[model samples]
Target: MISTRDLTGLPDVSSLRRLLQSLAMLDAILSPDWQYRYYSFNCHWAFGEEWGSMRNGSGDEFYALFNQHGCFLKGFAHEALMTPCRDNPPKLWPGLFSNVPPEFSECLNEPAFDIASTTFCIWRYHDGREWQLDDLKFPAGSDPDGSGDLLSILDGTPETYYVWAEEYYQEAWNDTSGLTRDAVAAVYRHQPLSNELVSAINSNLRLEDLADDLRDIGYPNQKKPA
Candidate 1:
């Protein structure tokens, strides 16, 4: 469902690289317990060990990866069900898109709704163009159901992968909690934060709060309660 044409007209690859770097750093600051995994040309970061498992017992696992070629992927999966659903499935947390620029929003593909599975997004940039696929599926195993591209890109052993449930945020707070604007600016470099990202981080890093923040930014919050 995704094609290289989608990667047209995006900012240079350097910008995307910086955005991902900043996001990884911020995620580290917000969730200190997470482990960082690195490969030769790519890296993976996650909040829990059973991130890609169909039998994850943790609350929910969040995972993200970035490739040297400017491909960014991130997603979350709910604790697996004893019996998989047969109909309308759970949507993924859109908080990953919180900091994404508005211009890039137009590049997102329509979501492919399905039953219980890992929900994710993939963005690729090359030759000053960009392409995005959102709400894609990630089933257990190395087969290329839909996430084949993602799997192929991260072809390396992880340096460190922890198996545990980690809190994303310490507690609710009014300010950045000592995170200076200068620090954020340094990671972002030329990339600017979307209003959605600012609100999502401000709401104490709760997934629900991030969902609300997405709604406030005018994007459809499929994870939000009706």
Candidate 2:
């Protein structure tokens, strides 16, 4: 099973936040149609917290909350045996959520993320040395909790996102969709937002069109000052 130790690919908290923002921004640019996009980041999610989320429209989803205290995240992969269901009776796997900071109590049961059905959980304090896990005893397998499937996007790489987006959004992508490898890489690098960069992903989209999305992500809408 993919253990927390195996998650070395996850970037540091600050970088991960930027990566999530970039992913959301890229998805917004690629899919002007909200109904077709699978990712979202809301930096204004609450008074002092930002929420990063992904919902596949199927039964898989992950939610991450960020604030000065740091980040706390929970994910649900319904197909995983560890996931809670009527049959599974909502019992999370051992140590899955045992050690999250009490200050983050609100995130433990947010209705939108469906905490009762969660399969994996992780957290990191703002000044901590590393991302903390609860030392889960995963079942014998390559991806018992489905972290391998869900956390790949958090691997801090543009190539992974590119390959996945090409297949996932291929049917919806058109000439005007304007996806290119370099464009994807640029966003992944958290490059400064620009009209040209926006157009590189979707000719039909412009910074003006992505105003709301950029706002929700708490990303700069205006170009960096020269």
Candidate 3:
């Protein structure tokens, strides 16, 4: 598992943005219901920012912010020791956001991202020299800060998401959805969306069904895809 602290293993800001868009678009197609979807992206989130997120619907979630300065990703594994729920004042772990640069200071209090629930965070500047984490020690335990699984999907592997989607959304829908692994990979590659690809994943959905998601995620719409 790639933890947020394992910055070298994570993709750079641009790649990570594309990957997050793919994840959001895939979830939008596979999950017709907006509320139940595991991932989401909003291109028009702010004047100069885009937001990406994952919510398992059982309290675990991760959110990312992208803009001119760079990218910031924060995750909250609700069951971890660092969870805000464990404290009387609903406190965040010490030093979690201490090193955030001025470029991303706004993200620290972004209400839409649920800043208070954070357990772990990683960030990088637009120059992309390195992905940085805080200089704090975490509680002793395996994956205590919840960074392990939360940031692992950003490895930019389509198969990683495919295997996970199969198990995570399995049979929860009409049954034929989410079986098209190649199509999923195509989206991960930032290929233009197409009718065939949409139906392959979920026979019930058409290209038009994903129109809003494409717009929201800022994904390339496929008038024609080779």
- Candidate with best TM-score: 3
Q: Write candidate 1's Cα lDDT for 1-226 as tens digits.
A: 1222133333344543433344443443344333431211112222210111111234333233333334444433342321122235634343434454443443243132122344444555444244565433434454323233323222111111110111223233223444444434543442334434444433344445333223322222334321
Q: At residue 45, give the lDDT of candidate 3.
A: 94
Sorted on lDDT, best first, the list reads 3, 2, 1
What does candidate 2 score on TM?
Answer: 0.90
Clashes (backbone N, CA, C under 3 Å), per candidate, total 3, 0, 0
C-alpha lDDT score of every prediction, in listed order: 0.34, 0.79, 0.84
Q: Top model by lDDT, which number? A: 3
What does candidate 2's lDDT look like per residue over 1-226, in tens digits?
A: 2345476667778888988898898888877888778889998888888889888989898888998888887888888867766263567787777777787777876777688878888888778777777877777777777777888888877888888888777754533365788988888877777899888877777788877887788666555321
Clashing pairs in 2: none
Model 3 TM: 0.94
lDDT of 3 by residue, 126-172 (tens): 78788888898878887888888677788888898988888777745
Q: What is the lDDT of candidate 1?
A: 0.34
What's the TM-score of each model vs. the native?
Answer: 0.33, 0.90, 0.94
> In terms of TM-score, which candidate is stronger, 2 or 3?
3
